[model samples]
Target: MPFAASLASAAQQAQAAAGAAGVRIETVEDPERLFAVSRLLAEVWATPPGHDPLASDVLRSLAHAGGAVHVAFGPGGMTGATAAVFGPPRGHDLYSLIAGAKQGGRGVGYALKLAQRSWALERGVATISWTFDPLVRRNAWFNLVKLGAHAAEYTPDFYGPLDDGFNTGDRTDRLTAVWHLNRLGTPAADIADRPDPDAAPGPDGLPFTARDGRSLWCRVPEDIVAVRGADPARAVAWRTAVQDVLAPALADGYAATSMTRDGWYRLTRP
Candidate 1:
């Protein structure tokens, strides 16, 4: 199929998925709806007293300027939201700035993303890009496995210091993801043939670094949030270790291809 037709087909599939999940997704143009989105972001990310990342005015401006500020509603009111900024004209991509959901809101995040994709496709954008913390295992699964997005770049401390609930003490390293609206199957299908990494501990009860061919395996703590609370130094150690492994590998043209259920990042040379 041609690129535009394929993208349209993908968008239809996404809309179907959202409908099956029974969530109402909407673009926030009204001031009241935009404020609700801002409040949702504040509550979901647990922004500190004065550090709301997406204030009502910011969301309104983005929406008014042809960008997407989508909100998802469930039985319990607003459940999830996503915001994206348009890239430069030459880039032909939408940069998804942030997405978050209320805790325990199953399927809310996925539905919101489907809505974002559908909205972008209707506007003729074929690619959607976003940055995410590589250490978050569940996010890795959602972005790479479930949504069929690929990591294109890795940056160290991309946001300096994030004082939000999930990113309080950690350096803000992130993986930039590129989701091709016209080619969803390719990314998810590529995972099956890759070699698996061993997460077993070595002699010192520390996780072993494993590799295969041109691929390097890296690990994050199973529960980084709990680990950070119990042992800040250890959490930092994981951060530094991941940065050491991923930064150089990505710089050398290796991409994070797949993540294991046990939190291993498989960085492989193309």
Candidate 2:
């Protein structure tokens, strides 16, 4: 099937599910609704991190100005969601990556992100940032290689003691990734248009521009299955290898933003 048609079919399913539940996954136009979304995040990805879905504050912050959030619901509750708040101080929104079991797989996350992309593009925003646990190879492919987002290495313990949702006291290392939300297609294709470290900045004024950013970055774990062993030698090897790629990019100006709690990878160069 053609890409456009396939996308449309998936969207139809999402919308149909929404209608069945009398729920919509768009921005919170009302303040109370915004609070409701934060509450949902706690419920969906945090509490059962396991507990009640109404126990999160991370969802609340995304409601402020220059912010945006999306929520999905089923017969009893929300299925899954993706939220981001655009800005500088918080690396332009690299918050949570919580998906409910009812969501199934990438289809839901992809749809939510596409919605976020559409919202940002309409506003002249060029990028969307987020973090993910890097240990999971699936996210590495989805966020960096597949989505055309780049990654950056961040210091360990990036978010000191994160025990909620998917994170549970291991290594807090992460990689920050960016979806050139505005140029999702062109940049991911045509290598000539893509950022080449040697080239000058674009008219849009981005990294390698006056702001000083790296062109692109990412990491694929050398050994996927046994990466998190407690062996000190293996630990050093993993840390060193990941840091080498991310550190240079950071020193060159890429900063870590979103992180994957399940995999321990952080998206950077934001």
Candidate 3:
């Protein structure tokens, strides 16, 4: 589709998503609204007092410089927020820095993302990229399957040791997700039939190797956050196991194409 037509379609989709989420999306420029976003994000991440992922002053600066800082407002006020900045000069890409939605708001995160996509498409940006912990299964499914993004790279300890509630004790192994603006709703095909039944098991009896050369399955903990809280040691072991399998595969020309609902990642080589 042409740029104008594509942007129009994206705008419609974003509007529909926001309506379905029971929220109103807005590109925030006011300092007070930006501060609200800061607080919302801090609460979502369970950050320590006075420690927010992105401070309001920083958000103001980004907004002033033409970056996007979108907030979602439901009946209870601000429920979600997302921030993205332009990538390298002439890169034609936007790097989404952070996004968080309050718990129990159905489709709120999805609405925020679609709003961000429309914002990017309107500016002629061709892609939006962000990083997420590869061990998080629901996030993998959301980014790769629901949003039609693809994993481009895997980096271990990408952010070092984060002090936030979610990343306190685990390695920050991340997968870079790239969303091509033109390919909305078209994710890479799932090639793996099923996790190899007879494959050798890794930590927690999860499959880690590619018995077949073209593709293979790697499993992650069903609920990594709960696992982290209940058994930190086991969580760390899961991290190391996934890193051992996925990092090498991504480096060796394999891309994680899709994630199963049950926490299996299908890493495939073209």
lDDT, candidate 1, equals: 0.79
For candidate 1, write residues 66-153 as lDDT tens digits.
Answer: 8988888787788889999899897779999999989888787888888788788777887899998887888887887778777869
> Across residues 107-191, which tens digit of lDDT does each residue of candidate 2 receive?
5555566556555555555677666655556666566544567654455666665555444435666766667653332122223
> How well does candidate 3 match the true structure in TM-score terms?
0.95
Q: What is the lDDT of every predicted structure here?
A: 0.79, 0.50, 0.86
The clash numbers for all candidates, in the given order, read 0, 29, 0
Residue pairs with colliding backbones in model 1 are none
Indicate the residue-level lDDT of 225 in model 3: 89
Question: What CA root-mean-square deviation does each model show from the true structure?
Answer: 2.7, 10.6, 1.7
lDDT, candidate 3, at 207: 59
